[model samples]
Target: MSSVRRAVSAPAARLGLVRALVGGYTLVYLARRRKMLRKVVRTDPAMFAPVGPVRALRRPVPAPVADALNDATLVSTALFTLGAGHRLIGPLHSALLSWTLSYRNSWSMIFHTDNALVVHTLVLGASRAADAVSADALLARGPQPAAHPRYHWPLRLMNASTTAVYLLSGVSKVARADGWSWATGDSLRRQVAIDGVRKEVFGSHAAPTAYALYRHKALFTLFAVGSLILELGAPLSLLGRRFGRLWAVSWFGMHWGIRAIMGIKFRYQMSGVAFAAWFDVERLLELARRTR
Candidate 1:
């Protein structure tokens, strides 16, 4: 519990409080999922769309990114439930993911966004593990296919691609809102009052204290400017040099602040896994002993 709090800072406590609310939603959602399956089996008339189209069945085999992400989260959840790597990320591993997000399916070729994030994180871990084993005389085995999805390369590419999505999200908000009217406190207050979206997902309006301040025009402008900085400067976190540390830490603070202030948790906040390009844990472990 302490580790969760320390790792995530003060927001962890709020997360703890809000978690059951989220869980309750998930529970109801699962109930609905079961209800849907029952309807599908029973051939319910309501299943038909107004235009006379029937929804498709579930996909067989991996849908590339979606299945891969499912697999990754499954393993992560198992490990977390067993208490290993539990501190690094909390129940985030088990959080219900929106695998059917339209944007992921809008494109025909590239993997879905959820899958992209998880697969990239896994590939990052795989490469580090391989680097660590390479220096071993006996433990280092031949090609690890599980670690290498392409089935050949012992070391995978570490792309650290989440920053792009982060920036894109900021950009998306601006584009959708017809420029950064979010710069104004009034806009933010109205957005916060949105019923189903916030109530169903986050349970409440950030922290009560922060919400009050969110009504201030000056503070809203400050937040808007800070968000712009975060979005524009996101790429800095990908740098491998000392500057990356500064950039990543700054983003970390910003993310936690957002969570604490708006009850909005960025799914990719501690996505250090996505920053594989910047750092490699397995390599660090291998190098820590001064081995080749």
Candidate 2:
């Protein structure tokens, strides 16, 4: 093959391999880890909060909410992954998922990007290269005039919304700060103190260290410095494709780590959608060509 051919084909090939692995993992994860997923989804108090109902709002559903949430989540996630209710189901569940995450959840520390990941994946997953990637693609460039099987409207909505949100987040930090470097331990500590549930959840995790880091001038200041750098650069992601993708890589690792080490599932159902924020969907096509 010519050099040009190779250049065009590599990404799709890589994408395919990733998809297969992701699919296999999803299969295994569903078959073997369903119980575990159920456990975490229910037991983790921080994962959900009892909000006022459409009418009056009830206390924790008599039966543990996790099992209930799992059943519903399974229904939505299944429809999304199977390409069942592409539009109607995915966005509805996405909204519900976003609403459930509260300031208390560890995942909420990052401006609730998890919601975007989940909704985008549920809808666009069919097109994903990873099992977490799902079979519902949100941004197919082909099959126009009919239903574009490549991408879903919900995913596009998410991409646009995420870009807007990231932009807003960057603007807020920059607007208030002494020019970035504002995230330090003090800020984190203050944030936790204000949010009752966060204080309860994470304060328990690192306990003495949480306080020590909160008080130690050097450590707090150092973390604070790193925090703003990330937040400030976040909006630049809106500038173009490359920036968004690089951000996706970091965000993906960050959330995945939260799940593995912290025992918290941060957007488990939508991790693959992060790729859409940065890379062109066409890249998948190129990878597909190479593998072929």
Candidate 3:
């Protein structure tokens, strides 16, 4: 028990930093999408197909109820970010936010980018993230413990969940397409060309890089193989911090390459938030300070 506790003991400050970044980003995201969220209630009932736990609600959610829930979600997200009454408020925040996300996906194309952020938020909610540098921590009268499993486990779990997404995505691609054919240049060339056609159909310009890369089968094949390697090796992130860092850099680079070639962006995955556990928050802060 002692060894386990020691193993998971994380600096309270690190946990606090992760909480603030994750929460703040989430709050910003929700705020930016507030208009779209409101439209959810106003959307036609014919378009609704409940997802996740929202399916348990049976019938379509009344607009007024949906409006109220959306409001509550925004408010709770704010509270969660501030780490105010986190223990009690966190679960409420998670539940409401989950509902809103499920509702959104039910009505249109599912945006997988936010999935990582949501998973991280839920893990934070379930942990004692407010033990430091938060409203709850500030309110406490006595000195707090320097380290605890409550903090580390959540980060670990979040890390695992994020990595699982990559692994599953890679596995799905392999399962659906089968063999190395999917990783060949011809496949990439076909995909890029198809995407280009898709963009033209929608009256949008395809990624400029896509056109340039389409004619180069050999180079595109290399890219396809690299992508496969990155995705398939995602589980190596669970090995340790070193492996996690390696995976983060490789994954981040992979996304950048994808954007350059396919003109696609997985913002959340590429933003370093999904791989937050691989690097030390304090070290990043220190480096930022040094640059100034």
Candidate 4:
């Protein structure tokens, strides 16, 4: 327990930066998706197979109720981001977002885009993320701890969660029949072609670049091997900050490469939220201020 506490303990300032980044990102993300979420209210209630807390409801919520919940979430999220009443607002925001997203997915297809992010939000809300650089900090009359376990533990947990996702994906590849063949076989090219076909048939266009490379089995084989290595080696981030950044970059490349070739986007990963742990956000903020 002591070791665990030590590992997660972080400076209040660092936690403050994390709170700002994660909270701010979530706010912007919510705003950007307001239209899509609004559609959920208008979606057929017959389609709502309740999940999470909403499962307790015997019936789908009225559109007005849904809209009210959505608005409440946005407001709570803004308060959480601004560091006002974060201890209360943080968890409220996380819960509201989770409920909203789960409700949305329940009404339709399960979208994995926000899974990691939502997990991060819950962890952040439960931690001492608002202890520094926050309204709470300014309002406190007593001296705060220089560092606290609650501050950094959330970041570590978030990092582990994100890494596990990649690691499992890598394990899945090799866990299948002749998984090793992914590297030596034409699995990569075939998958790309299939993705292209699927997209084209669905009224979307496949990446022409992917089609051009489909004939080159050798290059595709290399790509396959690289992807496997990246996913399997995700735990490298647990070793140190430098390793974390390296893994983050490789992961970023993996997401971008797949999108470029398959036209499938992992918005959260591409947005840099998954790799927040590896960055010195305080330093970056200082640099931005100086440059401005």
Candidate 5:
């Protein structure tokens, strides 16, 4: 019981730092997509196949209304990131984000890549993530609460949620009829070829690396095996910090490799923000303190 408790517990600053990183990334991510989202709203109402929280809507929202909601979400997100009025703004940000992303996904294709980011944000927004290293902490009138299980458990939950996503992805791949043969590289090679073809057909440039490496059977075999290991073995990250860090770095590299091969970018994973929970992000705060 003691060991279990220890494993789940962490300094409040760790959660605070994670909140900032996730929130900041989300802010930037949404800001960059603002124009694109505006264009998406104006897409044909016939294309609106609602998913997630947006399923409540029977039809597409007016472009002006969507623009207003998006701008509101951005404002709440900024407040959430700053850890100001968090008791109210935190959950508000989460809900707004969820609605905005869900609505965005309703148009054409669902972006599975944003799942982890949304889950992480939801967890942080509902917890005491602003207890330290935040505007809330700095403005508090008295001493802040000491580290406790509440702060730590959310981190554990976030880590486990991330692991589950990878595990499910691995399971989906292996649960197919071909199953274990997926590691033999034929499937991966075919996928790369198909993606390249699709891009070319759509008037977009295909990844040059895909064409260049088409004949390298051995290389594709290695990539296939590595991907399976990375996804299926994601649970190993829960064992300890060393294992977790290794897992994070490995996944980070894997996303980059996928980008190079298929031109399909999982920007969150590539940016390293997706794996922030796996490390002691509080060290970043400590470093800043020392440098000051």
Candidate 6:
């Protein structure tokens, strides 16, 4: 038990850095999508199929109310990112963010990619992630709290949460009737082909790479096998930092490849922010200190 605890132990600064990166990404994400979100609220109420926290609503809220909630979420997200008023704003930001995104997803399709971002935010908001490299920290009257298990557990949870996503994906694939045959690439190839066709049907350009590589069964097979390994082996990251970072880089590369072949973007994962907990992001602060 002691060894396990020690393995997960991390500095408060590390958590703070992750909080900044994840929060910053979400802030920018919401900002860029503000107009689209506004339009969504004005969308036909008949299309609203609530999911997540939004499921609590029997029907869509008034457009004005939805709009107000969106605005509040954006403002609070800024406060969350800066780590200002964390005690009061942190949990508030998490709830608002969850609702805002859930409401957005209620229309059309649910974006599974945002799941990790939401879960990570919930963990950070509930923890003492603002203890370092934050406005809250800067304004503190006393010395900063030393690194301890309290700081480390949240990160461990985040790491586990990330791993669970991939693990579940891999397990689902293997649990299918075809089982391990998924590694043969037939399913993946068909998925890419379908995605390309869907894009063209929707008046968007299909990924040329998908067409170019469509006939390369060997290449597809390699990609399929690699994907399974990455997903099923995600837990290896929890074993050590080196393994975790390597896995993260590999996963990031996989997302880029997916973007190229399918025109499907997992923006958070591609931005590398989704995997920030696996890294010593506090080194960025250390480097800044050294440069000064």
lDDT of 2 at 101: 36
Cα lDDT of all candidates, in order?
Answer: 0.42, 0.45, 0.79, 0.81, 0.90, 0.92
Candidate rank order under lDDT: 6, 5, 4, 3, 2, 1
lDDT of 4 at 125: 85
Q: What root-mean-square deviation over C-alphas does model 2 reach?
A: 8.8
Error of 2 at 65 (Å): 9.6
- Encode model 3's per-residue lDDT on 96-166: one tens digit a residue: 88888887787777777778888888888887888876888888856866787777888889888888888
How does model 4 score by TM-score? 0.89
Better of 3 and 5 by lDDT: 5
Ranking by TM-score: 6, 5, 3, 4, 1, 2
The predicted structure with the larger lDDT, 2 or 6, is 6
Per-residue lDDT of candidate 4, residues 1-292 (tens digit)? 9777766677777767877877788788888888888887688778888776678877778888888898888898888888889878888988998998888777887877778888888888888788877888888855866766766777888888888888898898889997678777487787888888898899989898898888888888788888888789888878887888888988888789888888878877887766776676667767878999
Clashes of 6: 0
lDDT, residue 167, candidate 5: 92
Model 2 stretches astray by more than 4 angstroms: 1-49, 52-56, 60-69, 85-88, 91-114, 118-156, 163-223, 250-272
**TM-score for all predictions?**
0.48, 0.48, 0.91, 0.89, 0.95, 0.96
Cα RMSD for candidates in order: 12.9, 8.8, 2.4, 2.8, 1.6, 1.6
Residue-by-residue lDDT tens digits, candidate 6, 99-119: 999999999899999899999
Lowest lDDT sum, 10 consecutive residues, model 1, at: 9-18
lDDT of 1 by residue, 1-292 (tens): 7654333222211222122222233333334444333333334333323210112423322345444544454454343323333334233444323332221233233333344344443332332222212222124344432222221121113234556666776777678645766655455556655632466576543466564664476776777777777776677655444666666666767767766666665544443333333333344544667964
Q: Candidate 4, 177: how far from true, in Å?
A: 3.5
Ten consecutive residues with minimal summed lDDT in candidate 6?
2-11
Off by over 4 Å in 5: 1-6
lDDT of 2 by residue, 22-127 (tens): 2333333344645754454445444444432311233233235645654565555445444444446546544444333321132224435444444444443444
